[model samples]
Target: MSSPTSSRAVPPSSPPSTQAQPAGLWPGLGLSAVAALIALGINHAVPTASALLVAIVMGVILTNVRPLPASTAPGLAVAGKRLLRIGIVLLGLQLSLGDILGLGWGMIGVVIAVVVGGLLVTEFVGRLLGVRPAQRSLIGAGFSICGAAAVAGVEGVIEDKHEEDVVTALALVVLFGTLMIPLVPLASTALGMDPRDSGLWAGLSIHEVAQVVAAAGIIGPSALKVGVIVKLARVLMLAPVMVWFGLQLRRRGGQVEGKRPPLVPLFVAGFLAAALLRTTGWLPASVLDPIKMLQTFLLAAAMFALGTGVTASRLKNVGGRPVVLAAVTTLAVAGIAWSGVMFIG
Candidate 1:
């Protein structure tokens, strides 16, 4: 028998084998980075446009236009999963308990009610529409919480194969949320809503933060301020909602390769910690500004990676049930928020 040292000798081809794993990540990462940069440039030119939305659209376009090289898969996977988590953790830094509490008890109650109510109504309507459970939950999370980011967060905890569902949810948010940007402002004006109420409605009803901001901006300066604050409040619910989803999955015996998902994912815990840190007012604008930029870039890159998974054929196969469910959920959320604004006023 050979000696232990000889038996453990490195193979002649081991060096390239070891290097290949990391090397494979560069192409896809580079592609995602490029797409994100283009998205940023477009958003900068059209301030009202959402960079995240543009990134995902570009990704889908590229995917349909041509096939990506196999080498890009590793980096794309990193962008979609690891980078996405890091971006979400950093997202917490944008929120502060102090700011949310400043809205006072009445408006706070309305915000909570909107989120909870929207989720329940969406799930109920989705079931009635014959939407798949996974898609229904994803749509509910996206519409009820913070839009595409919320969908991505819920997608992380779900062990089921639901990539198409995630994409569909994101697409729905973009579609309905975009429509709300113009419609909410016009409706607010026609309804004789004060700037504050208009802001509240936009913040409460709109799906994406960017969409809320656009709608609020169209109303007035005061509307912009209140709208952003209210939207952030909704974002604050993401951590708990993600944990709840994970717990639900565990209760149903959802597992990945025989392993149960953690009750609170590490990234989500990090998100909570980041928010707490923000609450302390320790990080100044000097630090926050760069972190904010980095967070946006990472999230945009992740969105691009996710978009690549979408294709014309897959989208065509998705059918119209999800579209109908999205429309109903959008109406449900807008109605609930509108009523809350009226009641609180």
Candidate 2:
């Protein structure tokens, strides 16, 4: 648990050379932006595959086919960390405290139960299956919360070198999230649940926000509204979960080399503040619309940046274990969420 920087103490008598580091981030940022643009275009045309998924696939393709330049590493890091955090903060604008509270205590309890239960069960199964601890946490977060965003949030706090695990978890999320778009509706119909309950099920179980929207939309407009609000309820859990993980990391002496993140990260704080601002009715639609656009673009770009971290060799090293873990985790979450929906209704 020693700090990463402790071993390589530099002597103060001979300061390091003042050569300025090259501004290499532009290339990576530019590439990520391009990927995001391509994803947006694809989403517009197809309307099934989410832009976030498209961007991640593009990043993986680029990395495997033609290796990105070394100079782009700095920028890619920026996109993965800073841009991801900023995107998460802006995400708050899409939610409001009033809307979440309106769901009533019974519905809120169901959401909390599913999320907490999903995280615990997934992580336990992961451990039993021999997955690494950090990877297990990332996978659990992805399944229990808001897909790639949740994985990114957990990774930021843990500060581990398991970037491949994050990508693996995200890949699984995209896969099942996509599949659920069709599967959920079928299940809802089979169960004979009304549109409202179906929407709640989708919101609780689906991994990504876009995937929830797509699934709920297929049911009906009423379903879509219920699904989105429920999904936001899951999203709201991200902050406290992140703080708990951060505290766990600190307690276990897992702190990274430098300054540790705040107990409640700055991004989470910004997210709460933005949500409160939205509740105030002060944010005009014109401003909110653009912010929403920017939020999506930023998250897309961040996904692409994370994708660049996944090379063929690394995937080969991981083999199929992560995928299996993802599949099991996804099914567990879907079932648990559905059970909650049934019990509540």
Candidate 3:
């Protein structure tokens, strides 16, 4: 004979305690950490292979080969979200305003144009091919900005993004960016371009920072310096672009679960603050070096977490449209960048 209100009330013991949350996260986090360490080892052995790429690929392979335990979910979520955001913030430390501004106004304009133009062209082509809006946006962001990192950043803002879209976008970044590593240097030699021009082209057109570095390294030290700086300039655009995405989602009345995304996500703000800190020359190389290593490991771990979501079955359903879109955008950006290089000269 309990009262109606008392009968309806749930017992306190039924709800999981907040204290248990940290313990629950450890299993998955440990798995991701192990995978990231393995990826680092592989990258150390093969200097040409990117640790992020290696980590993601390993995650994909491991998950597809056999499903992960349910216990890993919480940790994986933290890796994908929190670790990824922190890594992105640390990424800003690598960029210096002085180095980018040194490229001159014309080069700066080219960098902006490439990011904007590439995004537009990718969206147009994606629409023509009947690609889904979310997937297309992800692909466009990845190619136009900084590859997989851009893709991950955009995914955080978009309320309706699927894990499949992220996996597809990342795969495209790896496939097309890798192809450009050798092709760009060979093309530079064939065109008889100087190191500076070649570096500009690589920095502007290549999808990933690592790929640009590899390409520029093939040309010479001067090219490597210019290429890295130009690539960082593109990385700087991630903040504004992510903000734009969040605003667009707001306009559409999109919310994740019941919560609307912020106009500027906390992580994006952190990224900007880190960049300004780097620009101030407050941090010495000794401090920056360890931060860089930590950033890389965090990013690699997050990529591995994201990669676990990719399965062969899901990828098969993605079709060939995205592939065509990637190829078209790759050429489009490369052509636009080359034209800018010639004009600036």
Number of clashes in every candidate structure? Answer: 0, 1, 0
The C-alpha TM-scores of every prediction are: 0.92, 0.91, 0.92
Where does candidate 3 stray beyond 4 Å?
Answer: 1-20
| Candidate 2 Cα outliers beyond 4 Å, as residue runs | 1-22
Put down candidate 2 lDDT per residue, 222-270, tens digits, no spaces. Answer: 9999899989989988888998988887777776436665677889899
Greater lDDT among 2 and 3 belongs to 3
Q: State in Å the error of residue 221, model 3.
A: 1.1
lDDT of 1: 0.83
Best by lDDT: 3
Model 1 regions more than 4 Å off: 1-20
Clashes of 1: 0
lDDT of each: 0.83, 0.80, 0.85
**Alpha-carbon lDDT of model 3:** 0.85
Best of the two (1, 2) by TM-score: 1
